[model samples]
Target: MKIQILTHTYTLTIEVETQETILEIKRKVEYYLGVPISSQTLSVCDWELLDGLDLDDYPIVTEGTKIDLTINNHIPAIEIRRQIHITVKFSSRKHNIEVDKTETVGSLKEKIHIIDGTPIKQMTLWFLGVEMDEDFRKLSDYGVDEYSEIIVFLKTTSRMVAEPPSRKLRFVVQTSSALLDSTCIPLEMKDSSTVYELRELLLVRKLLPIDDYIFIHKQRIMRENCSLRWHGVENDDYLYIFKGTVSRG
Candidate 1:
């Protein structure tokens, strides 16, 4: 089963087997978070998971369960400054960038700008097929694990130009594992269509059950009022569908 490891600053998902020991899980956590196994404490609902026990021994541990991680020791400032290298792929070239896990998307753009001379305003970053549109959000918030490849697309200078009235774009809509058994629904829509219109189209076609759904394009929660083109959705792009609304507050 897959589970989530939640720390104070970030969250990550990992696949685990029922027969795996807790200590083994800690090692995997160490690989991901750089937190030493000796200083890591994992818990579910405040119940500490002991090292020797297998996941089978814990009845509450199951699929999609969130395990809270606490660092028992203070890491040295030098260790805290350790940066993971990620690949930034542009249209013509790809470069490696050293970045802290806590670095924000906006800061990453600045780094790219310094190295490649691309204007920060002209850059749009994509990770795991999702757009990292929120400037202030940390890279971890977008599930940007170590060595993740970020695709950078440069925007044209025609920002003020109006979009065509009607242009067809073919894309895929992927549902969460909990929804539609993680089905990939192929869709073709006008570029001018808003996300709300996409939802209505799904409902009209009986492709999705009537529910409050949130659309995510390139990992960014899509605005219902905004058109697909405005969201930087390209042909053959994949959009994710989740079952809840985002609360800004």
Candidate 2:
């Protein structure tokens, strides 16, 4: 099957086999783009790919899946955190780590991704048997504290329940005056689609240039990992687009 490699400035199509390792694909990228394999990081839905793993290890990666490519430009990517200890249990294994209570669940997932090669999209965190469904909410908001035991479940087809039927949502993408000359693009998509997917669709269709973007709905910033329905977006709703990322406070 073919997959797309998305860089900050361009997208490349690469045919891949299910049995192929991520490191092998990185070598191909190195040959095609002249970027060293050591400098490239491939991810799908913010899940970092492990060099030792093959495509089959990641069920989310499929035909036409878009993988994000991030280049290490010798910049320090680590951030200082006010630490609190926590235990993340996944199946039969457990990992103890330090995290900031002020960070969001999404950030926590990223930290888990760094520790283990699990994809952020595949993880479902729980505390006190209640699922942490809101990625934008802080750990403290979920009542997570020092030495909290966070349960982790991997999302798989077998573990999934019957999904709700997808509904078509027609809406307008209103760009800022500095972007697209204040153009309003009409779009139709499924309610199940995420804001990040919508942004990828725009970039793939050349409706928007390759760059980081933020979407806002009804004055509230949209979460990339969340669906339109989760944001209370409806048909004919106007989604405002801006040319930057959100600053998590």
Candidate 3:
């Protein structure tokens, strides 16, 4: 089984047998991280794990279990700084960023833009499954701690047309497959069209199997349930259609 060990600044995945004891797991973590087992406090969710207990006997220690390991030692206030290392997940990509606790959400978004080239206006940050809408709030206000995982979603815009429009905005779709020829087929689509609707249109125009293809915008796979307006898909935006399974790294 795969166990994910999360620390203050890093996340480590380890494979262990079902019969392994909690102490054994601690030893393995110590060997891999160079931290003493005595100094580490391991827990599944919020419940602490006893070192003598066998992992198989624990109902919570199943496959893909996430174990949180915190150091029991205390640091001096004068030497310790109020900063944190967090993982920001954007689509299939994950970026580790070190930020000060006093920094606002808007400032963090700007920092992410500098690193990944994603526009600040289009970025939406979420922590612990809750959206961070108050841009002026400090990171500490949201209870953000070290090694927290923040999800980033990009919003795209659609082109504006004059009143009594005869057609929709044109988009250029390209295929990632090398075997197929790339075509600059101008697809006229409404800004209100859902991603699934666009996928159906691609099936007819690109002549590719519907199930085998996924639409990607700005390197992120567009969710089928959302419309172009939700994604901020603007006029002349490049959408890459890939054949096969999409990798979420």
Candidate 4:
């Protein structure tokens, strides 16, 4: 079958056998692309391909199938790297590190792990109040310059306790726009809270202008009357507040 592999900045097409495993296909692509298989994430039609799975198993894996490849980490293209100082804030304590601008956020997190013994998976990094969830993105993407500060928040698992009758869902609300500064706000509401109710709260609280702004999660605009539970919004989930239109008289 003919398959296409797409990366952040490149696209490659290759022919593969139906009997070949996904790992084998990845190796072939890696040979041509020079990107390590370990860093590559393959998805076909938004469904992730497992290394152990055979290509023929999925009915969608036919000729001319387009597979999306995402690199989990960034690889520097330049040989000579310049170091810059950066500060990471974890609760009350702040840790500083010297990093190269070309290095990936994952690499920075690894350095932080060495310093504080915190596992990279449990730590979340934020720049300018926006969560740096995409480890593949370089520090420069967030406009990190010399002496830039990144907020570090550690995720903790709750100890087992008596189950409550009903649990409220807590999610993060943040603003994003070229015209406004980024801001993160924590919100707690019942599982049955609808988007309309949240909008009303934002209107009353004056956190965001209701008529001018809209809520977005995972790039999808939230609709009124849809419950938070319907969107699968869980604890610490981020919702972006974006300006819907420019106010022009």
Per-candidate alpha-carbon RMSD to the true structure: 12.3, 15.5, 15.8, 18.1
Question: For every model shown, what is its TM-score relative to the native structure?
Answer: 0.41, 0.38, 0.34, 0.32
Candidate 3: C-alpha lDDT: 0.69
Question: Over 4 Å off in model 3, which ranges?
Answer: 1-167, 246-249
lDDT of 3 by residue, 212-247 (tens): 455666544455765664455679998766443322
**Sort by lDDT, top down from the best:** 1, 2, 4, 3
* Residue 176 lDDT (model 4): 56
lDDT of 1 by residue, 1-249 (tens): 777788765566666679989998886666445577888889999999999999999999999898998887577533643557799999889999877676678667767876888877788899989999887788989988779999998788874333225689999999866568899999999986889999999999998998777687754556687678656677999988856443321
Task: Name the runs in model 1 displaced over 4 angstroms.
Answer: 1-164
Please give, for residues 1-249, the per-residue lDDT of candidate 4 as tens digits. 566677654456665678989998877555444567787789987899999998878889887777898776475522112458889888879888767676577657766876778776687889998888776678888889889999988776652223223359888887653324677888999966788899889879987754554566654445565567545567889987644321111
- Candidate 4 regions exceeding 4 Å error are 1-166, 178-180, 245-249
* Candidate 1 backbone collisions, by pair: 130-218, 130-219, 131-218
Give the per-residue lDDT digits (tens) of candidate 2, residues 114-227: 688787778889999899988778899999998999999989966654334669999999986656789999999998788989999999999998977768776455678767
Ranking by TM-score: 1, 2, 3, 4
**TM-score, model 4 to reference:** 0.32
Whole-model Cα lDDT of every candidate shown, in order: 0.78, 0.78, 0.69, 0.70
